[model samples]
Target: MGRGQLLGREDGAAVFSSRTIAVAPGDDRVELGFRFSGTEVVVPDDARVVTNGAVVFGSVDCGAACAGTGTGPEITVDTSGAFGSVDVRTVTEAAADRADGDDD
Candidate 1:
């Protein structure tokens, strides 16, 4: 189909979302990218990854090192339903500069 249909968003320690995405019917892929770090990922329950290349997942981690596409697309998130992204970016404040460096 066209670009993935992004639906809803809910926020918490991690963000929750719903997106209606799909590859062409009969076709098994969509040109998409996924990257996460020190975080969690929640794929839609109804989604499928056809023709698994080097993709793997488990109860807690996305296996493989740190690449999305390798010789070819490593993983393809096939969907006609919703999925979620884990927003693990924490907000922090910059440290205040000491008066030592101030000319005033």
Candidate 2:
């Protein structure tokens, strides 16, 4: 979602991509589908992630939320010999925060 954009409560899930996926504060969920090689998924550390059929090399840094007990929303991923790894970390609420040094 764009900066200052707020999702309504009725809004559905967001689709994940290979690039940097920035999720807004009100985003409730995200769906990740990997059907090709070199696919990497990045999500916030606070998100609740559930993966199936995925072959990841590196460990997901889910932190205290790895057990699907985070206060944030859910993130589901399904891969079949396509995804390389998933890097989990805290993502800023807005993409512009990275450029304006607000994330620091």
Candidate 3:
């Protein structure tokens, strides 16, 4: 299936306002795109990140405990009981690196 959208529900209803990034079938992985205010972020497969909301990348679930800045959109992924790596960067820095082909 293609990308799907999940909108937030109303009061006293099933509210699912959290955005998610998922990988499509036939591919080993997928990239999740997120836009908040004026910033855009990408959460890759097998990895996770936290922002102002919650994101479920795979078997892992991530989110914030309170409503605050830079702590909402959280992401989680199954590490398969192993330690993984996480790279955090500002939107501007991320974009600059992409433009310079200096992903390291």
Show model 1 residue runs off by greater than 4 Å. 1-18, 37-49, 54-104
Clashing pairs in 2: none
What lDDT would candidate 2 get against the real structure? Answer: 0.43
Per-model TM-score versus the true fold: 0.20, 0.40, 0.25
Q: lDDT (CA) for every model shown?
A: 0.25, 0.43, 0.31
The better-scoring model by lDDT among 1 and 2 is 2
Question: Which TM-score value belongs to model 2?
Answer: 0.40
Compose the digit string of candidate 2's lDDT tens values, residues 8-95.
2244222233334454555544444332223234456577766545444433333333477666667554444333344343443333
The residue-by-residue lDDT of candidate 3 on 52-95, one tens digit each, is 32333322223221112343233322122112222334344455
Candidate 1, residue 44: Cα displacement in angstroms equals 14
Rank ordering of all candidates by lDDT, starting from the highest: 2, 3, 1
Weakest ten-residue segment in model 3 by summed lDDT: 77-86
